[model samples]
Target: MKNYLILAAGLAFAAPAATAQSTASATGAAAAPISAGQRKAAEELLAATDSEKNLSATIDRMLSAQLEQNPGMKAVEPEMRAYLTKYMSWPSMKEDMVQLYAREFTEKELRELTKFYQTPTGRKTITKMPELMAAGMEIGQKRMQEHLPELQQAIAEKLKSQPPGAVK
Candidate 1:
């Protein structure tokens, strides 16, 4: 679960930069301070969506999930916790997450989202998001496994086409 959440979070954070494509523009955007209202609204949205609670749940499950999957890891649980704490602790990342959302959304939008998240349907969506994400990931993995031979063949063809001494 930790690995899954980390991958999900990594993709979430990376998606914006990947689309931005230029470091200078990305840096400029990062440097532009968010307005107070925007920050407040973003924080409110996070709270309404139970972002911190969700993160805590993920972290809580992580250790048990790891141990279940790899009993050998029990011997190194302390080391694993130290590493996860250093990099994945919510306290270290909450402000950055708030800023990320604030940057991506207008104050008005954030407020509207907060309002929606407070609704029953919105709450349901929040509750179901992890399950939905897991299902989608499973679907993707199945598709990838089904098509892996094609991918291997494509890679082989590409390698064959490359000059003997040159790497593609």
Candidate 2:
């Protein structure tokens, strides 16, 4: 009777351990995976940069400057401005940018990124990034000018090889 009682107690304890293992396996299998839409939304959320609004404004200013500097290109300025305005539709752009950024980061990574962005240096970089981009564009334009003749010649030759009435 004593041996039988010990065996029963041991069986009782072992039963719960076996149950716990099965429960854990079931839960691990039943968990739902992330959907594509959910992933996309998270990505867009993360991609939202602090500089988005200021960057749009800076781009508008640069376009205006370009129109002013080259009067001949002024004929197309209105169309260009309209296109830029359409492309930079602020609310949707912001949403998409945020989603894109969010996709690349896990929840913990986003928390870290938000903490950094909240700091003074991060804020300063966010504010100045648009102006820095404009400066880089100005430098790129100078380089493009130097290569324009060669670029034009290459385009002309490529066009010449196309079939007659083909879209140029």
Which number leads on TM-score? 1
Q: Return the clash pairs for model 1, or none.
A: none
Instruction: Give the TM-score comparing model 1 with the true structure, all chains together.
Output: 0.79
Cα-lDDT of candidate 2:
0.55
Candidate 1: what lDDT? 0.72
Backbone clashes, each candidate: 0, 18
Clashes of 1: 0
Runs in model 1 lying further than 4 Å from the true structure: 1-29, 62-66
Residue range 1-168, candidate 2, lDDT tens digits: 343244234332222123444454556654334456555544433343444455456556656665575667677666765765565445535543444344345666655666666678867876776568568867989999999999999989988999988954
Estimate TM-scores for all models.
Answer: 0.79, 0.49
Worst 10 residues of 2 by lDDT: 8-17
- Looking at model 1, report the run of 10 residues with the lowest lDDT sum: 12-21
